[model samples]
Target: MKKLILVRHAKTEQLYDYSKSDFDRKLLPRGHKDAATIANQLKNKEIIPDLFITSKAKRAKQTAEIYAETLGYNPSAIKKEQFIYDGYTTSEMIKYLSQFNSGSDTIIIFGHNPDIAGFTVNLISDDLWHFPTSCTTVINFNIDSWKDIEVRSGKVELYIYPKMFK
Candidate 1:
């Protein structure tokens, strides 16, 4: 089985940063956070992903860094994939991933939403899902090879959203 954790980046700035290009917008302070402090979500989960990949966008990168640090993963080992920031539909992203990183049993990807949320919904069910900032969903695929994964075949192991914290 393959495990995938998808995270939509934390709240950002610059109308939440609409004027800012999607690639460079940074995280907005959540009250006293004053920075990206979203580590707690991954703490007790013991999430040590075999491969940690993130969009090159500033916000996504920052969120990935926080999760990596919290999980004791080597920050530098995290890969920055520009294509993620560029944007791709659910199937395109899945094909891209299957082509390159099939060796990993567990993979974590940090990226933006509507796309991220859309992919998760396609994986677990046909129902629509709203993926908020800092949202993290853990999905377990029954296939041994990522290339064999099918839509609606993924089982959602856990789904965490920032609202649950505050």
Candidate 2:
């Protein structure tokens, strides 16, 4: 079986320097706390992933780092995928995930919204309109290989939001 944990990056500062790209925006104070809250919840539930993948964006990377630290995972071990930053497509995500070795039965992805939410719908055939910041959607696929994962192939396991922790 394969498990996919899709996490939306925590809340980011609304104000950004006009000179800097959106990719450079950092997380807000509440974002840090929200990230940690989810991490701690996963820790308590013993829901650790075999691999951690995140968007190259600063906010996503920071959220992934916080989760890694909270889960006692090596922050350096996190994998950064540039495609997640802009090439936010279900096909792109699946293609990237299919490249992982079969040894990795479970994985987590820290990315942006719309794409993340769309991915979930494509995988489970469920409409999740609002995938809020720092939210997580866990899906379990019966397939043995990631390549076998298809549209509506995954069963919705959990849908967690930061507000739930608060």
Candidate 3:
């Protein structure tokens, strides 16, 4: 069984300019706090991934860093993908995931929605309920290879949000 954790980066500041617009938006103050809470929850729950894949965008990178740090994961294990920055569809995300080495059983993808939301809803066989900011959804699947992953191929094992911690 392989595990995939889909994380939607926390709230971000509104885009202000065209210069590096999508890549420049940083996490808001509340976003940082909420991300910290979610990171701690993942740590407390002993949810550790073998690898962390995130969009090259600042906000997504920051969120992945915080979660990896709080979970005591090596910073080097976190990889940034340029495709995630522009890929807004589930098929694109799945293609990226398929590129990973088959040895990895658990992986975390920190990215934006509706890509994250769409990916979760489309890949998992169960209802998501919610995929809000700073939320994490864990999906488990039995596949011979990552290339076999497709829409609604996995089961929703868990869904968590920062509000649940309050």
Candidate 4:
């Protein structure tokens, strides 16, 4: 069995300039605090991932960095992908995930929504109400390899939110 953790980036600051979509906006102060809370929670839960993949966006990258630092994992292990930047569909994320080798038993992906939300609901059989900011869904799949992952074949082991810590 392999564990796949899907995390939505923390809350972002309001957009002041329209030069870029909300995707380019950085996390707010509350978002940083919440991300740290989530990171600590993950550490307490011993939910550490062998590999961390995050979007190139500032907020998502910062979120992943918090997790990596809190988990005592080298930040260098985190991979930032350009395809995850903006407007990526759930299928694209899944396809990118499929390319990961089978050597990694645990993987965490930090990206945006409704693709993340959609992926969680569609790929896993369990009920996921929604994936709000700084929310995480951990799914376990019974497969010999990453390539064998099939849609709706995963079971939700845990769902965590920053507010839950308080």
Candidate 5:
């Protein structure tokens, strides 16, 4: 079986600066708190990740770092995948997972919304319309290999977010 944890980056600053790219935007103070909140929840649940993958975007990386710190994971080990940049699609995410077939049984991926939410829906039909900031969803696939993961081939094992606690 393969377990995948998908996380949406925490709330980022909605900056109006035209000179800055969206990829460079940093997380807000609330984003840090919320990331820690959800990470702690996963820690309490004893969810240990075999690998940590994250988007190269600034906010996503920051959120992943916060979660790593809270969960006692090595922040330096978190992979900043460049292909998972801001405009990635659901199919791209599926293809990305296929590359990790042998090594990691359980993986945690941190990324942006619409993309991550769409990836979750394409995997399990979870009807996730609004994947809020700092949200984490666990999907369990019956298949032994990540390459065998087809559309709706997984089950939602857990769904959590910071607001769910508040």
Candidate 6:
């Protein structure tokens, strides 16, 4: 069995700077706090992931870094993949996850939505209609390998949202 944790990057600055690229946009002040809140909550619950995957986007990377530090995960182990940024599809996510061997049983992915939300919906039957920023959805797949994870086959374990902590 394997556990997949889907995390949406924290809230970002709303003001659109025309000159700056979207890929470089950083998290807002609240976003930093929210990310830390979620990380601490996960730590309290002992939900440590063996693998951390995130988009190369500044916001997503920053969120992953916070979790890595708070959770005591090695910083060098975090994978910053571009496919997560450009592809933004369930297939892309599955493909990236498939690359990992069975040595790692738990994995966390940090990305933007609606891709993150969409992938969660595809994997589980629960009414997970939205993935608010800094939210984490934990799904357990009964399959032995990630390659065998089928759509709607995951059992929803937990859903952690920042607002719930407030």
- Compared with the true structure, what per-residue lDDT tens digits does model 5 show for residues 1-166? 9999999999999979888899899999999999999999888988878899999999999999998898778999999997777567767777888999787998999988778888888889667666899989989999888888888888998899888898
Model 6: what TM-score? 0.94
TM-scores, all models, native as reference: 0.86, 0.94, 0.89, 0.91, 0.94, 0.94
Candidate 6: tens digits of C-alpha lDDT, residues 34-152:
99999998889888999999999999999999899999998778988887888566776777678786788899999888788899999998888867999998899997888887788
Higher-lDDT candidate of 1 and 5: 5
| Count of clashes in candidate 4 | 0
lDDT of 1: 0.78
lDDT of 5 at 94: 77
Write down the lDDT of every candidate, Cα atoms only.
0.78, 0.88, 0.85, 0.84, 0.88, 0.88
Q: List, residue by residue over 1-166, the lDDT tens digit for candidate 4.
A: 8889999999998787878776578888889888889888878889889999998888999899888998887888899887766657656666777787667888998888877788888888777776779998889999767877778999988899987877
TM-score quality measure for candidate 2: 0.94
What is candidate 1's lDDT per residue for 74-136, written digit by digit as tens? 989999998887778878878977865456988989987777888888889635477778878
lDDT for model 6: 0.88
lDDT of 5 at 2: 94
Question: Which pairs clash (backbone N, Cα, C closer than 3 Å) in model 1?
Answer: 14-17
Error of 2 at 3 (Å): 0.5
For model 3, the stretches where C-alpha displacement exceeds 4 angstroms are 16-20
Q: Which 10 successive residues of model 1 have the least lDDT summed?
A: 31-40
Structure candidate 6, residue pairs in collision: none
Clashes of each: 1, 0, 0, 0, 0, 0
* Candidate 5: segments with Cα more than 4 A from true spot: none
